[model samples]
Target chain A: MIRGWLSSRTDLPLKGDAASRFLPWVVAVMVYLAVLALAGALLARDSVLRWSRSLTGTLTVQIAVPAGERNLDVAMADRIDRTLELLRRTPGIDRAQALSADQISALLEPWLGGGAIVDELPLPALIDVALVPGARVDLKALAERLAAAVPGAALDDHGKWLKDLIRLALAAQAAAGLILLLVTGCAVAAVVFAVRTSLAIHRDVVEILHLVGARDRYIASQFQRHALALSLKGGLSGWLLALITLGGAAWALLSLDAALMPRPSLAWLEWLLILLPPFAATGIAVLTARLAVHNVLGRMI
Target chain B: MSYAGGPEIVSDLTFQLAAGSFHFLTGPSGAGKSSLLKILYLALRPSRGIVELFGRDVRTLGRADLPALRRRIGVVFQDFRLIPHLSALDNVALPLRIAGAKEAQVREHVSELLRWVGLGEQMNALPATLSGGQQQRISIARAVIGRPALLLADEPTGNVDDAIAVRLLYLFEELNKMGTTVLIASHNESLVQRFPHARLHLEGGRLERRTA
Candidate 1:
């Protein structure tokens, strides 16, 4: 059965029409855009998940240095110690440790350059806090307690920063989704236009076939087969191009500092997900061709 | 029937072709011979009047029903209308393929029919490479390949010589002997006189029947 279907010829001479010659190229470009957009959306989703996983149960406490004080004064040191003590007493607190001045300097080395000026700068003392997993600490009450314990101290739950980052990631995802939608619409329109032009160019052939007792579906199948073959060719090329582009981008990202940027990586399943656009383009092409043929044939005898 | 608000090319005409009958549609140029053939082949609908084919009303048949009806009728167009890209064999095999015949059967049947039409050597030749008479034979082979119940030909012999036209009519006669009704529309008065079959003579959109 498969062999017979494969050997069946298209009676429409669809492949020779100048109108559909560029269909594969059009499909390739559309699939390429779709893949990139989908990849961007997937990457955004991964970044959001990774950031949330790492930052979920952590907090930071900053102790601001008093104005005109170029160094960590005794009073600020005492306040840092008090804040640490209070955090250790909290029920859900797992561990609290003040970052050493040298450690803060090392963290700033990337931007500030390793110089004696970093030592002279009045840097605030920072405390890194880890909470017990699934802890439900009240951030508002904790901030108030820290303020009372140390006049210049504040508890930083990182909620505002994480929220803004998540918002940005979500916006990127939404934009990618919109782009994918537009690409799909454009691909469909392109296929429709191509099919219509082909129909017009081969109007005589179609009429002959119709007179020979070919059903609308039989005639449409010819166009459908043509579109399917073209789309598959275009889809594969587009997918290969996208994979090359993604590989290049990932390789480029590897050169940047891991601490500075979240690495854009996809799991095996995500790579598989990225393969959908090509098949989707094929499906859209075939269905569009079939519908276009039927629509045009319906208008005829 | 009228065309897009133009004057009626064929009007107030009624005729029925009995099963297993043969006739020649004789008319001069602009006498609506092709228009009448178009109505019979279900390519055009009449602006007014009932057209019944194979026991079904053409007007009542839906778009989906047309194919089955058309499959029962085959048409030989005046222009030949051969697909320029397809080989003669493929073109002749079209009706059987459209009917969903298996490839082996399609090949076997098409090859035999092409041989009968004297196009056996030109099976692989494109329509553009063949002469007008050769194209006409290919068109006829395509029409009769599936053994349609009704065969409608518009100027099927206009391109062939007198001898070949007589031979083509004999081919049609052979098909008619096998229970297929045949209608050949031509302006060749001498050709029509050579055959004893009934003639459907059309003049200025009216039909006059002369029984054999």
Candidate 2:
């Protein structure tokens, strides 16, 4: 009832004068940056989880024949077969397959162009292994067994590369989080400046309301409502712009050759996560305005 | 209260206003009539005195309790501080809105009060467009429309002509008859002489009460 009366009774929305007209746009930019940061965080999280899932409990065995060695063909075949047999016999090994020559050629086609000279080089024979989920195979023991089974055989779990990938993903996520915090701080500062300008401009109105027995909370709520509305406007705009940017980037990435990089696809849940930053921005703006109004009014009476 | 390292604005002041009484606070310029009203309206606290309102010591009341007491009091300023953006009707309805009155109730009461104040035709006019007398009347309407227990007006008739001033006085009288204690502060000797209410005369921050 009171809200309806207040809305119908007055049309005093707090808008900045010409001097402060850029406040909403500033808020919009802040929200945009914040959304981007959040999106980056989400993307990093998604990429890390996907990479971890694909790499966990998986091993790649590289059987490299000595460079320029005589009769490399027979040596490579024996090593590859021995590695595969050893991997297949393992207790936790789900599947072990030696990749065909064509598959290996395709894998290197992007970096090393297909030609007679490239085909002459002695590339290592690669065996892909999948382990059963939660199956604990002692990798050191397996490596020792592989060494005994075949000379010049190595079990490469890709641990070093996986660790670096995870660290990079985590670092990107942390950086995104830091950006979000800084954006929120900037938003708070903007809100405080706007609220202070409003208070200064409407000082007489505040005094009249105070004399008429309006509580501090009541006056503060008016400011909070004003700020919330502005922030919501800015936040929605920023979110839409972010979505457009993300969509455009995804489309651009789709136009590139698939072999160049991993596909940039987001799950539906991950897309929904993009909505969080704008909402958080609006909440921060409202809280900042309320606190600013309350603190300033506290000094008055 | 005293200023920072300055002489006291009001001191040794001890007085109580009975319910349903009216008074005219008259004093020379800078004699602190407005200052006393400020203290009465809970705007200022005296440095060394206990103040009570509606039989409650104001010093003992918590901050949360002030709004209730303030709602019971209506104050009209000397400058007629009307919100320039709001219409006269909206200005008059401010207190009612703050009190959470329904929209229909607020509209009805505000319209009726504006009509009574001869502002029915100008209800939708902004304060910037209104004349000094019209603004003063609007301020008075806003202060009294909530039917507060006490109505305090500072120089209520300072800007109006003699005829309108008399009508405004009659409006204050009508509100007083309805059980609102009224206090009007003015230095106009002729106007103060016309009213037969008690006079609260101030000199050098000291108060002297004289009943009619």
Question: Given candidate 1, what's the lDDT at residue B100?
Answer: 85
TM-score of model 1, chain A? 0.93
lDDT of 2 by residue, A59-175 (tens): 988877766668888878878877888888899999999999888888888678777755777778888999998999999999999988887778889888878878988898999
TM-score of chain B of 1: 0.98
* Structural similarity to truth (TM-score) of each candidate: 0.95, 0.94
DockQ measured for candidate 2: 0.68
Looking at model 1, residue A82 earns an lDDT score of 95
Q: For candidate 1, give the lDDT.
A: 0.89
Flag clash pairs in model 2: none
**Candidate 2 DockQ category?**
medium
Instruction: Give Cα distance to truth, residue A210, candidate 1, Å.
Output: 0.8
Off by over 4 Å in 1: A1-8, A67-73
